[model samples]
Target: MTARPPSPRAVAGRILRHPENLTESEQFQLKNVPTHYPELDALIRHVRSFAAMLTGRQGERLPDWLAAVRQEDGPPGLHTLAAGIGRDRDAVIAGLTLPWNSGIVEGHINRLKMLKRQAFGRAGFALLRKRVLLAR
Candidate 1:
């Protein structure tokens, strides 16, 4: 059988309905994407070529907001992260930072999938929907 061509609206709807299928990195790319986009298959390769060369722990923690803390009497606010990379403290000041993570969202999604699987086809659509909606 021949496959049907998906309408642009159908493609957009599928993407909207299953947005979680896209990773954080992929979502970021879509936000600033230039018009007249090239083939999707070549995007990863092209982007990888321009990707940052992160080295060591400091580089590994590219998105991490902080690298170190200061003494109570030593400073005031958020600590210097890039300074820790070079052991430079001339402009060092505070000792606090904000907490941020997408990990919890990923965890909840995994939990939902596990719950759906453990239902084992025993629960009807209504019951499954209720369980998902009413779960604490």
Candidate 2:
């Protein structure tokens, strides 16, 4: 979930409906499949860079300037969530703050991948539905 102070059920609904509604780091890591396409090279690079940062391999850190920005609420820029969590504005600014998507969507994606691989792109709709229902 977004980790804001709302109800867990509501947050879960939001998470499932729009994984895009995420923390700044989550947004960076998520693949906007609809917009990024055909240009596999650029898409791959963006995804890789995002993944590296999320996984803490890139070693880049959030900037101190973000402390001021966090007070604003337009987008989930570093400042937005930082302020939400009452974090020391400077703590994440200097250190590479590692944030992540909640893993709920990732689990669903993984399940879908498994289904696709097992079906080998030949499964009928009814079978797919049955498999998905039974799998649950």
Candidate 3:
């Protein structure tokens, strides 16, 4: 029997994943992605470089990367991403360069929102406040 082609989700996951983390079979699958979809080659390259920048805190390279993306005849999604970044260039650079993050505060805010949604019309402010404070 012929082997089935990989699903789009699988291909996307492989493209987004770090190269070192891929298994042998996954690596093989990823290598074949560009053969099936030629446009994906550029997407894969851009995604990998962007991931590297994020991990390496190479914010200084963003301008060049954005310029390349804007100049390329690649996917429209990429252009959109570049435009969005351009609109908030300073904040994006700060986020990529700075070591500090609001992860803990965001997590707490998310938890509070979830609790509020779950208790809507079922509980009052006192119960919601208690749930938020008592939550681990």
Scored by TM-score, the top model is: 3
Root-mean-square deviation (CA) per prediction:
16.7, 17.5, 1.6
Per-model CA lDDT versus the true structure: 0.42, 0.47, 0.91
Q: 20-48, model 2: which lDDT tens digit per residue?
A: 45676544433332243324333333334
Query: lDDT tens digits, residues 23-104, model 1?
Result: 6654554433333243432333222321322212223333232322222121222233333633632222211122344678
Clashing pairs in 3: none
lDDT of 3 by residue, 35-131 (tens): 9888888889898989999999999989989998888778789889999999999999999999999999999889889999999999999999899
Better of 1 and 3 by TM-score: 3
Give the per-residue Cα lDDT of candidate 3 at 113. Answer: 94
TM-score of each: 0.29, 0.29, 0.90
Error of 2 at 51 (Å): 14
What does the lDDT read for residue 53 in candidate 1? 20
User: Positional deviation of 95 in candidate 2, in angstroms?
Assistant: 12
Global CA lDDT of candidate 3, please?
0.91
